[model samples]
Target: MRQINGQNSTSTIKQYSSTLLLMGSMLCSTHLLATTTATAYNANNYNAIQQTMLAEFALAYADTATALHNYTVLAIKSNSTTVKQRALNVALEQHDFKAALDIATHWVVQEPSDVPALFYLAHIALQAHEYELAAESIDKILSHDPSADLEKILAGIAPESKEDQTVLVDALQNSQAKDNPSILVIIAALEAQTGQFEQALATINRALKKRPNASNFILMKANLLSALGDEEQTRKWYSKASRQHKSNLEIRLAEVKYLIKVNDSMLALEKLEKILQKWPKAEEALFIAGLTSIDLKQYERAERYLVELRNSSQYQNDAYYYLALNAERKGHYETAKAYYRLVDGSLYAVSRQNLINIYTEQQRLNDALRFLTQERVNYPQHASFLYQAQAEILKKMGNKRAAIGLLEEAIQHLSDDPELIYAEVLLLDPFVQRDRLDQLLTLLLDLEPNHPAYLNAYAYTLALQNRRLDEARDYAERALEMAPDQASIMDTLGFVAYLQNDFSTAAKVLEQAYLLNDSVSIGVRYARALYMQGDLGRFAQILKQLQQKHPNDPQLAPLNSLLIPPPMPKSS
Candidate 1:
């Protein structure tokens, strides 16, 4: 038992006492016994006991005095060198860094030629961010034989360690993980994150040998393979898991889901039907069956599955949401509204706001306002819904003050997140009180000088105000450089050029942006630039095209109702 400061932990004894408090607590046998017990030496049981011991030790050593007392006892109970090493590891995990160092220092002095002891100390120093101490510890290991294989490995290795991640990364990269298969799985997971699909695939294959039935390894390997566009192999691994564990219904369903993703809906449907036959009330299988139908565009089958699911009293957020999409497609706004409401006021609020679009499109202004009011009541501080509601309602009512007030409220949550601050600046740009927004912008530069959103927002605001076009132009260029292909960034750059009467450059940039994403806002700005440049022919072409896409958009009225003046004839 580890001590705290100087006190002997009656607490370690307290845990063994508390273990009797609920000897029948929720302990999964699978966690304690990964396989049928043939011997007492089970790694899974060892793992469980190790985790529980770690928890107890961490609590006991909250005071350093108690930790030292336990360390002295531990030093006598086993081979001094080996047991002392384990104590150092436990101390480090408990965040008693000085104690870990003290133990390591003793081990080094007692066994001056112990490479493992020196390296352990090096790792402890690294964890403390004592890079100088870490280097010195490693140097002690290298001094032993200078040419030893162990010394060569530690010295040759560059520790990009990146914290606890170092254990897995160093284990794999240092080529020491062949002896410890658990390290192989950690390496596979790390490589998967870094987009090294091939290396990740090979590592997972190696790890499966040590624990062939490790579900996490199989699932991760399947997902990584899927991410690399190998849908066939992804399903194969899931099927392999299914075959290994005959009664694993969830894992078998994972295989079915993968088939649906790969466009083999018929095969996925067969599996879903089997799952239903086995357990008729399996809501997940039913949900996926409906979703698979939706993916295949078999709308009739999707409607049937969804209707049956709803009748059976299954939880159906996805089903209801997709059915809402189905209703919207069939011009049934009232039906769509009901399903959308089920998902409305949820932490996931996008489903409801999308329904607002339908209300807006149908010109049911009262319904849209009612929906917005309800959303405001639900998520009181969610800036997105509040701002959208304010923007829509105030724009409809021509109440700029109320709209700007809502936008400003949204800005308060966005003080540290530069993107939100930038959006707030644009929303406030029309107001006379620019000082409030300018304050946020100046604070933002100290945080994110090259942020795409900040660069574009500052550029566009300066351009719109017709002040400091040179500064605006530079910011716009910087925004484009940060995110070259982003449609909104390109629009800012084009608008900055337009403000400087560089309309030719504006037309080029804006046209390129419009090609990438035909956003109504970008279209309006680009068309306006073409008109400013006296290129009304090009402007009219773009305007006519844009109006067709956004027929009921309020901005479309200006372009459509006003006849374009005739273009001067070209001299051949």
Candidate 2:
């Protein structure tokens, strides 16, 4: 309700604007040209005048760009302080910083005592990168209120780069407010961002001496020590802070947060439990506890904490989302679906995704497709994703023919989205339609030559066919270079070497791949390489372990053929 001029936000601007309109209507009835011409006019004339004023107010909400222009015109024509402030608000809302600065400067000139005007002037100056002007405005505010806290204002000056941070620090240090502890802390935080950790520690320690019991300084010092890699000293300071600030919930919560960051969930949960013992219904503590429980795989405890959060209106939607996850983790499909349906707002999209995943896992393909169809209607721009989701469900159901047909139809509509095209290539049968498979792989490689998936798939396919060993080796090598830690790509390189009769190299690469992934396919390949290299004992050991681990996997038949000699004694 604050006036656009320098008034506090809680002021009754709506009431004042209404009174002004009523007075304007009354004056229009007697002295205005249009109404005065109608001598016998009644409420109709006053209603027309009221409608005119209402229309102007409605314009402010209808279209921001047009409203800004109209407000600027009104301010110029009437020279009213209120109208100028309205223009300023519109300019700020539109992110037209130059216009906002001009309006705010005019407001200050007209109403010199307006503190909000000066603050906004500084804010706009900072955004425009007019550092000197920003400093001048900040100094005016500090001079106006000697005890003003510039922390919140300075916090807005986020520098995205080292040079930007240095510029901001220099600008702020030159200001009269530089002597404030809050300003010193802001500068120290910026210094830390620029990797001047030693300078940051010195500045923060200086501030702590000035205000020894300030929790913020203590926390900052702890963070600086952590950044400097002094773990022991950091823990000491954190413990000291919690002991000194026993009544401060934020200080206690900060310690728990640091513990969680360092992956010390046991200690974090212990501190959280102690905090909850005192304030059982604290929303933030309950939320973090719910997340920690989920991370620790305590589904029941997570559900309990998240359900308690449902009582707080602010976290109702978030609580429902977490509750859905808890039920999903417990394999309570119906319960999770019910919880997901109750979720709304920004969580709606993510909850819908979870529901799709749950339906797919449960093999309720129709339900998943139904939800995706509705989602496609709701978000038409995401049609490509919805199509791919349907195809994925078909693929999971072992209906590759239907999945391929769906992708073909989708490509006709969407026309060569690289992701969809790549997906279609994955469904290609290399044995039945080698030509078509090669064609699609070639197009995919052309689309994204450096794509690790494309490179690995092409290399693995060629290795399988044994037609282009050198090309396959090159592609697999490129894929390994691109994703050095990818187990599948490493297996591809091993398989290519095996096809080229490099059994020793194949054994080494497959061994690495097996260690990286422990996949049955990689283990079988490693076993085969060892068998071919005459390491019969090691091959037998690996094959036995694979049989025990996989228990009659059909994919292990080739390795089994190599291991078992087909009843040679029975012929004798």
Q: Mark the 10 consecutive residues where model 2 has the least summed lDDT.
A: 6-15
What are the per-residue Cα lDDT tens digits for candidate 1 across 60-83? 657444544455344433234434
Judged by whole-model lDDT over C-alpha atoms, candidate 1 comes out at 0.65
- Candidate 2 stretches greater than 4 Å from native: 1-98, 159-168, 206-218, 297-299, 311-390, 404-572
What TM-score would every model get versus the actual structure?
A: 0.52, 0.58
lDDT of 2 by residue, 293-316 (tens): 999999998888899987678998
- Candidate 1: misplaced stretches above 4 Å? 1-244, 279-286, 297-320, 326-332, 344-347, 393-451, 470-572
* C-alpha lDDT of all candidate models, in order: 0.65, 0.78
Best by TM-score: 2
